[model samples]
Target: MFKKPIQKYTGKIGEVEIGTGEKAVKLGGESVLPFYSFDGNTGNTPKIGMEISDVYPEGWTNTLKELYKDVSNDTVKWAQFVEKKYSPDFICLRLVSADPNGKDSSPEDCAEKVKAVVEAIKTPLLVAGTGNHEKDAKLFEKIAQAAEGHNVLLMSAVEDNYKTVAAAGVLAYNNKVVAESSVDINLAKQINILINQLGIGNENVVDNVGCSAGGYGYEYVISTLDRVKLAALTQNDKTLQIPIISPVSSETWKSKESVEPEEEAPEWGNQEDRGISMEVAAAAGVLASGSNAIILRHPKSVEVMRSFISELLG
Candidate 1:
């Protein structure tokens, strides 16, 4: 009789639990390649988060606005609505208006939004900054202080700001940190190492090893994901074994393919459908590649990915 080869790993993706109690969402803890359950443990099933902004988003398409019209005006209301209606595993609040280059909002206001959203829902909450290294470090500090004891997941502690973010957010307030890096295995591993050097445990880290979901470089993302997963499982790379989470919606929606008007690209077909398709496709690609979780903007995209994940993991 012919039998299949069963390969197992010495290391497992460190599991991270967000929020608390029964409603908490767990990610990672896989002992084998994603979905290779026949060989070893798949750990916790991948999670999906619905992404909303701290303020009403300005450039969102009409399709998305219409779907979230009732609650999009208020950040807390938006999260509550999604949690109740769609039942996502978590909610991601992008501090869009906090950018000093843009709205120049204060960290205090942003933290208030975080407190409001966290209070409004039982599901876990994740917060992302405006990518300003200095501002984000301060913003994360305030958010950590305000949300202390609630234990939210801060979107990132990048190479430039890992020290500040890790210190204030993780050490001071007991929140988790997302160690983000560009889509390269070495960079990914390095960031994890740096964050770990600060005494942050594997269980407290999630990796955002970049995403090419918006445009043309999916192969890079796939390769990075594959290498990171292989190292974690086969080579027992502890730093690389952390779970991955990518923000797919913001990436896809900002791309020209999704933003172009029909009149400008008459041959491209309907605009909204194109955007949704792109979002779903990009998210599915990353999930298959090895993302432990993905946050999406559109409800339709979330609905589709939920079913896709269920079908695949089933």
Candidate 2:
């Protein structure tokens, strides 16, 4: 009985190599479905990214607030702490206070913060926003300029507002940019198309397939990531081949499965344990599905995931 050999696609964004080693982590180049070595090569294992914030998150689970409390209020300290303590390969910095209806920090304020963190660290940084479309447009523009030539990897330029952010990343900083769209494959393709049209080099872009916590909707995210890999290897679509990102830590915080205390949901175990489980499950699922990078919180979760990845690669 002869089974067909798995097909392999070598994906690239302009000149950027997809996956690990010379690239961030090997993710987009697989001939078969995930883990089906008989189908193709799973040359690169997943990589973990630590998530840090510019300001304190008002309602982060008490468990996390306490462990990271010492450095949580200061972005430079937090980033340095994670890099030194965890040895994370990448860092995700979220500019949350810049939300117009939130902390309302101005573009200049955001730029200063980014510059400070950039000055303090050497690992690649993923600059994300507070998810407010309009505010992020202005905020990322200034921040991108301040990070010019640092080769920073900007968190995102999504649909409806890719123009400004993509332009700044392409023209000013000459750095990498993440293009996020919903779980929809078409929308994901479109955003990647638009980014290239803006003259942003392909090698300088990654794609975020939208973060999903455990309990509900995780399947959709995982499936979409699988589709992107399929498109890259089978369809050989360049737009879909860019590295996929998972903001696993932030998305997990909002899930009821991770938040309800044991007294409230005794069968689920302690709230902290459930939360940590959710984080691990989410990381495992995303890693298996083909995400090259993950943004995570909680030192324990970071340790567990790193160990898991180490075992898988072994």
Candidate 3:
């Protein structure tokens, strides 16, 4: 029997570094298709980030509700608990409460929470805005300043909002910027171009390949990410080559398979486990597809994902 020869990616576009003031991170080194254990090298493996919020989130599933319980209500304490107990490599802080109808925390208010959380942990941070473009810009502008020199990775700078947020991250924090686009390869590229045009170097930008849940367009999202990696490696497209970022928690949150009651979907098994498992599954899909950093919810889910990554790397 003839053993099949394995293909190795050339050079190392994924190996480029993202500057963080004095320090930098090597983005590439993946020799495999995401997490194909039986395939080439996934040198960096995957990183799991625990998600917290400056204000309590509404409409969370009972599974999350029960696990986090009271701690979910307090962002500062929540981050500390995750950092001290769970020991995740990163902590993702969502500024959801800054919404006008939500906690309505101003940019200043958001910055303080960021500062408090930053002081609470040594693990790197992923600070995300509430998704309201304008407010997110304002919130992250302050957040960038507060988190400056800490080398944190800012959650996002989308096509429409890239100018303000990207500028803030580059000028204020010297933090890494996540360039997000809906699940379109062209859009992903365009945003990357836009960020670079803003005088923010590629060394500071990460591609946020759009995300989806297990049952909701997962295949499409997966393929899109796959294209990104191929473009980066094969096409020599630098825009898609930067470390991929995905908010796996937010993406999986909407899946019925992740949030519906067990009784409503008995084939899924226990409700809590089903939710956590779906979150893990969605995350695994992205990891398999090609994501460098993922923001996740639930300590249990993060634990399982981290274990899976260990097995892949080991």
lDDT of each: 0.88, 0.78, 0.77
Give the TM-score of each candidate. Answer: 0.97, 0.90, 0.89
Give the alpha carbon lDDT tens digit for every residue of 1-314 in model 1: 98998885788888998887578989998898878878878889889998898777877987788888888888888888889888889889999999998898999999988988888788999999998888999899999988887779998899899999988888989989899999999999999999989988988989999887554477788888999999998899987989999888878888888989999998999999899899999989888878999989877898899889888777
- Give the per-residue lDDT digits (tens) of candidate 3, residues 1-314: 98877666652335434423322345546755666545666656566778887766667887677767778888888887887888876788888878877778889988998888886667777888877888888878888899887777777888778888989887666877888888889998899888888887776887887888765478889989888888776667766667787888987776777777877778878877777877898888888778887788878888888888887766
Put down candidate 2 lDDT per residue, 53-158, tens digits, no spaces. 8899677888888888899988899989987888776788888888888779999999999989977887667788878888888888898899876677777788
Question: What CA root-mean-square deviation does each model show from the true structure?
Answer: 1.2, 3.1, 2.8
Best by lDDT: 1
lDDT of 1 at 170: 87
Q: Residue 181 lDDT in model 1? A: 94
- Please give the TM-score that candidate 1 achieves against the real structure: 0.97
Cα displacement (angstroms), candidate 2, residue 24, comes to: 7.9
TM-score, structure 3 vs. true: 0.89
